[model samples]
Target: MSYEQAIAALNDQWSQGDMDSDEYALERERLDYERGEMMSAQDAPEVAA
Candidate 1:
């Protein structure tokens, strides 16, 4: 699944109290970092061989 979808599911879990605040915050931070990395990679210019 996409990062956006995963994050949304995580939000649902947190909202439902299936996860604690610490765990939710850690997971959300990781997901956000990963999403940022993916987007940065996509936006980077290609290098010539």
Candidate 2:
């Protein structure tokens, strides 16, 4: 599955109270930051290798 899909699934799990709050928050934050970076890179102009 895609990162976005996986994150959404994780979020659902958290919402269902199956995961610890602190751990969920930390993981969600990490995923969000990484997702943001991926989005940023996608928006950036490509440079020749």
Candidate 3:
């Protein structure tokens, strides 16, 4: 899942009290970084086939 999607999912779980604030923040950070990495890769030039 994308970072934003993951974050939203986490938020849902957080609202349900399935996770604590620290856990949510850590997971959110992880997802955000993963999303950033994916975006960076997409921004890179494509290699010729």
Among these predicted structures, which one has the highest lDDT? 1
Ranking by lDDT: 1, 2, 3
Weakest 10 consecutive residues, lDDT, candidate 3?
40-49
Can you write out model 2's per-residue Cα lDDT over 1-49, one digit (the tens) per residue?
A: 6787979899899989989989898888888898877777788748323
Tens-digit lDDT track of model 1 for 1-49: 8997998999999999999999999999999999877777778747322
TM-score ranking from best candidate downward: 1, 3, 2
Clashes of 3: 0
Q: List lDDT for all candidates, in order.
A: 0.88, 0.83, 0.82
**Model 3 Cα displacement at 24 (Å)?**
0.5
- Of the candidates numbered 2 and 3, which has the greater lDDT value? 2
Every model's TM-score: 0.79, 0.63, 0.76
lDDT of 2: 0.83
What RMSD does each model have against the real structure?
3.3, 3.5, 4.2
**Candidate with the greatest TM-score versus the true structure:** 1
- How many residue pairs collide in each prediction? 0, 0, 0
